[model samples]
Target: MKRILFTSTLAAALAAALFMTAHTVTAAPEGAPAPYRHVVLFKFKADAPKEKVAEVVKAFAGLKEKLPAVLSFEHGLNVSPEGINDGFTHVFTATFKDKASLENHYLKEPAHEEFVKLIKPVIEKVLVVDYVANFVDHGAH
Candidate 1:
């Protein structure tokens, strides 16, 4: 009886330790910076020239080098067959280390302002969304 009790206690202790380890591994570290994402969608004016749109895309892509706060930048034309895009043809995403980095780049950077001015003439509608990225466990169903 004592041996059985000892084995059960050992199993319980092991299970508790594993539970704690799993939780600790998944939890974000204290004071770790959450990733910030800046997303932009643009709908060009019907009369805008293709060359001008391409120039705007090129200018936006160059922001990564001009702005030290940019962690990553990507831009692409919409290709979805679903007609739900509401005339938006281009999308750009800029990732930063944190919200402060994003704010500095967008609000204070001269290069960004110039890029904005370059695109303003051809942009019919624009949508921008910014958010802090959240951790997700894709393995978990």
Candidate 2:
């Protein structure tokens, strides 16, 4: 009757308030050691052949074996969930220990220089961004 309905409404309101309070109180702590994140976007030239593009992919993929600065790395072609992206031939993500390590990766790594040579002809444009991960949860991926 009225009493049962009143108790149920109060219980639901209390649960929601408790849930919001817990979410507010449990934020991650600050000043965690930062990880350098690198994102690369490649656009192949119009005249670039298919085999040459594939070679670029393969050559870039080989860097993980030779360069230890590449703590985490992956390269993939664009395949949209909605299926409508006609741009950006390739995307690469590489995580480094820090900013200086990333610079070392570019300057000291022979394999990366070699990769540049492989892509010089077929690649028309290259975009790179380096960032630090704040609260990167692997579970989301």
lDDT of each: 0.86, 0.79
Q: Mind giving the per-residue lDDT tens digits that candidate 2 earns over 36-97?
A: 78998998999999999988888877788788888888988877687554467689998887
Candidate 2: regions farther than 4 A off: 1-32, 81-86, 136-141
> Largest lDDT belongs to which candidate?
1
The list of candidate 1 runs beyond 4 A from truth reads: 1-32
TM-score of each candidate? 0.75, 0.68
Over 17-130, each residue of candidate 1 has an lDDT whose tens digit, in order, gives: 766665443333458777789999999999999999999999999989888898899999999999999999999999898888888666588898888889989999999999
Error of 2 at 133 (Å): 1.0
Clashing pairs in 1: none
